[model samples]
Target: MLDARREDLGRMLRAWRMARDPAALPGPVPFRGHRTYLTQLDMALLLGVSERWYRALERGEDRGYAREMIDGVARILALPPRQATALYRGTGHQPPRRPAGGVRPDAALLDLLHQQRRVSWICDQAWDVLAVNAVGARHCPWLARADANVMTWAFSAEARYQLRDWEARWAGSLLGRLRLAWQRWPDNARLDEVVRGVRREPGVAELWERTADTRETSDDAARPMYFPLVAPDPVDVRVAAYGRFGDTALRWLVLTPEDPTVAFP
Candidate 1:
């Protein structure tokens, strides 16, 4: 039973991570592979501690890393504000509250979201890839053009190829975002289902046990992130866009490439 709950928490963590927007996080862009722009050693510096001790915290070996330390990590990871608070309070012990709504996209918003440059979509707080624009279809091969779960893309073999730095960068960022979405609108059944689906993957399952503290602060200068474009270049092409609430009932998201030279064509 403990193991089951651990897995459930892991899934919730995974879902939450996928829902975050890097622009909302803090810190400079990190070299790929470090968690939320900080290495275990960097975390030590942030905590005024040492790498070996920080490694223990990361390994889940420390029974008591100060609330401040956990919060520090969450901030570094750019966890959605609520998730960060909850994480600090819970000491990495809780999963997000279950989401309440189903995955539904507004028709007009869908049209607009697709019309944008790259690819974008809408999912209720559950992290499902409820919808995607043509650019998403064209660029993000790992994500299903039809009903999809961002978590699926995170865990898929294709995702590793597409994301390149899945463990440190994409996985943590995505999960942190997803958690924020859940915080904003928990009790969404569709989001829960998506969370469950992605938790089945091994790498995701492993990371979920640690904590939901993963941040990625993307500045205006930074770009949207995408993958599977012309290969040889490992970093997924950067894409950017924002979610605009058309009304209480609908949201519009536009995904566009950060680099104008790299046209969608």
Candidate 2:
């Protein structure tokens, strides 16, 4: 793809990357100078590709790219509708049949969940629970269901019971992140529905306006929770977060115990 059109693509890619709002970017993006534009290396990490490969692709020196990889870039950069269409067309990859098919849960990602001895789960950018491992299911039974969502769950009575200081720590921060996700994916109907549902809760609509500094990965801090199986009392947990795998459509998270010796229930 080293032709003239390919050269145009390379330039377009560079421009799009520059114009992206780092605040709206879905994944962890390192700050760069004053712009805070996502660097090539950050793009590589989020796409689960080597920096060398991503550089080659950006330069249009790479050929026969996978549709999933380009789609991942589009998602991260929050490309405009026209530009996104052109990017796919330029890459020669067919568009997904349904909007919902755009970012389906990865089976391979789900398989990884089962392999984790600790509580682990896979979700999409919208925080929809696609799959949870046995340990995760046992620990948080609410997460095992098909329609489970992180945003909606945190507002539920179950979450209030399980989480200590549920409103101040968990729900407020999570709602802030959901707003950021919505900024990145305004066209995402599922995520929009999530925001809508979360707002309908008492006082949440007003609360949404105040949390402007949160992101999905902001849940990294140790959270106090009541895990009946783990202990009779509340315990502080460090929830480890990860991004996309080979499929580039999921987020894998594991809730690691603070005590290394603590066994999975």
Candidate 3:
């Protein structure tokens, strides 16, 4: 039975890989340097494993690949969430738990994000910027990037200028939030990758080592956050986050100007 399962998984993976158009995968389109279907070599490269290792798995000669590797393969193939979950189960590995709330935002949430007056955006538990209003994009240009992630921006060189108090206001708070997320999804490869990138920064690494037990406190009293904008003085805004009810793994963040009379452009 084990042998049969491995063979079936290998065949399925091969078919999935062959069916995808290299030009149509998500994110930035790869340069069409060569006309080819996503090959075994491509899968190997994407998963950071050798072609031989991937071939062995595909040939039903190896069924010892870790869950992370299986997941990495699923992502590279752009498998739908359900198919990915099925693949994990078919391979005799447990799939990662879905976010408590859900995966995709509902119509109402989308409408709210589109129509909100304030700078509002929705991010997943991984801090992946899913949807952002025009106001939110205008205030924080980084939110519009292909790899728009809160943790990535916080430790970037640009953060030094964009965030008024990087250490006190941003870094510590972001790290604490990430810690909470880690507690919930400890096996998340993307989250682990973000932390690894952060640790490369000396200052953030020190803070992460020191604040293992620290939990970030919410600022409900409308504490001011300064952002360098077009105005002569830095813009003062108050940020708040609301988790979506039910099984949606989404959070809405609103950034309102500190001065109620002043509206966001």
Candidate 4:
């Protein structure tokens, strides 16, 4: 029941909007910061095209928009190139050839992850192990044996022992995100593969069969869980899950303590 043209424009606006950085935008920071303030004129100038032509393209009234123009607009908006291309394609426009540079972490990102003494790791939207810091590696031995998967860690016997309240604390949150993923990227092949793989993992398989619903919102705080380290007392860690789309293949995750400790203090 949705108008195709309107939907395309709306998606273009949303993708471009969310992709911008507040600090990078002009002005003294508007109500919602930089992303919201980037206007049609700005988009036009960024694409090196006329305002009229850009507006027509965005409005889905023009089919002659150049692929280079869309690429330029995506670059200026900091939109993930793939999603940006999808946006253009939705509007019946031809997108540029796909870039061959698949999700390679630069030296800077590698260094950042390697230097983190805290239990921190990075996973892409498709749940690929882009990088894991040393402390995170120590905290998660599975990171060594195989690739890192947040879901796999939650379901394993060792991890379940570490996180006692697995169902109450973890399942709902992860499932909620999975539902959101299903809605956002219905045709995502990688996501489908991950869902199938997780279902095959014992505990995760059981949860997949269960018909229960739990919602995860950005405002919700992570449920507190204690992990028994070799130390005399259990290390209390607050598990927080956050998502941002920069490199479509990169999502940063940080797990820190509710109270300060020597190493993380």
Candidate 5:
């Protein structure tokens, strides 16, 4: 592992570059002396960026570097797990996660999810299921599936039978939130995978193309849904949106029954 002891991003990057064997990399050799390390210009050429742009980025003078560019640098430098995360943070970013739906909720988060008396579910930024409360599980047993995603299910044909009004109450609003997530974390591979999954279903691609529903949250509005085996009747719910420990990467949702006399069945 390369020494990331240096707090400076440029220094860390330089160290990583120097640690690499120039001959091992697939690139034209630099003409200069020692032949021990790849130069900044080499990094720039590999990244498809201008030398000035890469220099500014290395010097920490550039704060607006794109996620793809950072990812490219990480791949090119072959940064170790810890060092990769550090590089991302030093560049005012977060490291990309492995595969889609790989997020594991910690004990505290799992406890928080189980504590909710109301129908609730916890998901990662990609809307992949992390935890589903027992109450929620009974209401929609499909959530118990190993690879369940609320957004993906919402757009599926089976969801039409479960939701009250699949298009207006759920589709537009739900798709809006999905689109918003895509906009917020375009570099998230899992999130991109989720989007692709949704669009593959008939009519979803057309709906996604529409610009009318960009609202991130699904609160205030009625989210009418059905639990056929459990409730039989459609339940009007108010969707409460939240993030775990102020981290947007994890989303917590509580579906509160609207009527005071009514409770989740």
Candidate 6:
């Protein structure tokens, strides 16, 4: 089984390397003595590892590379979330966790967010806003605030007026998601701070206490929500959240209008 796992890891690494377009790498193409699809040496340079070490891993030598190194390779390869998770598991490591602080959305994710017609934004496990499309910013003005977090916004006095069915729709759901995130990353200090702060808000503590389930559930029905700054008209929108493959903690939240007649300004 161990040998099989190593073989699988090597096969995946080689396939990903071959599939990657050198021009699509996150930054400017390196001044590789020559340019084609990234070569093993180029990958080694990008990963800050000796070519021999990278080659050993790709050859299934099982040299016991550090988790950080594996994660760096995944990032450099721009592996899809699922493929990245598989890489970690094949190497017998826990998948990488979302950073507590905000993270920049990769080019692919950013492009997807921009392509969406609905209000859409991406947040880390701690609910820190990582990126927001123009529609998302227009509809959610608070997201533009410095260091904005979903927990802080949902529990704020402003949310009481903005979000309809505050207890069931926004509060309960947000708390459930937060609870899930906390359970996954109990040691994250920033997450602890956000939880503590939200618990302090009036009435929030009781609501949180009532929420026993931590798993996130889908709510398919469209619900009325008011965006006072952007749209005075009450809009029926459905909130959809998509978790990335490798980084399950990083999620894309999209608000789509149920009523096609109601348009975003």
What TM-score, computed on C-alpha atoms, does each candidate reach? 0.50, 0.58, 0.59, 0.52, 0.59, 0.58
Q: Where does candidate 2 stray beyond 4 Å?
A: 1-102, 213-219, 245-248
Q: Ten-residue segment with the worst summed lDDT in candidate 6?
A: 25-34
Which lDDT values do the candidates have, in the order given? Answer: 0.51, 0.72, 0.69, 0.57, 0.72, 0.74
Better of 4 and 5 by TM-score: 5
Candidate of highest lDDT: 6
lDDT of candidate 6 over 144-226, digit per residue (tens): 44356788888999877778888777777778877777888887766887899899999987887788876555656677789
lDDT of 6 at 183: 84
> On residues 1-265, what C-alpha lDDT tens digit does candidate 5 reach at each position?
2224323777778788878765543222323466767788877765677899988776656457887688777755656778788777777777777632244567776777778777788888888766687778777765654456788888889998788888777788788878888888988888898899899999988887874558545347777777564466887888887875667777888888777666665
RMSD of each: 17.7, 15.2, 8.6, 15.7, 16.3, 12.4
Candidate 3: worst-modelled 10 consecutive residues by lDDT? 24-33
Please identify model 5 stretches exceeding 4 Å from their true place: 1-102, 216-219
**What is candidate 4's lDDT per residue for 87-177, written digit by digit as tens?**
6676666654443123555666656666766776666555655456657656565443223456556556676666646677666677667
Per-residue lDDT tens digits for candidate 3, residues 1-265, read 3388778878987998898776543322223455557888877765667889989888877557776577667655767767777678776688766522235566777777778777788887777666677677777766755346777777888876777666766676677778778778787766776777777875777788887866556544344454444455656677778776664367888887777776766
lDDT per residue for candidate 1 within 1-265, as digits (tens), equals 2344434444544455444443322211223343432345544554456778766554435356664455445544446556554555445544334321233555566666656665565544444445555565566643333234566666778767656566755666667665666566555655665677777877677777664674556522333244536334543344343454543333344444445556665
Clashing pairs in 3: 101-247, 101-248, 102-247, 102-248, 102-249
| Residue pairs in clash, model 4 | none
Query: What RMSD does model 3 have?
Result: 8.6
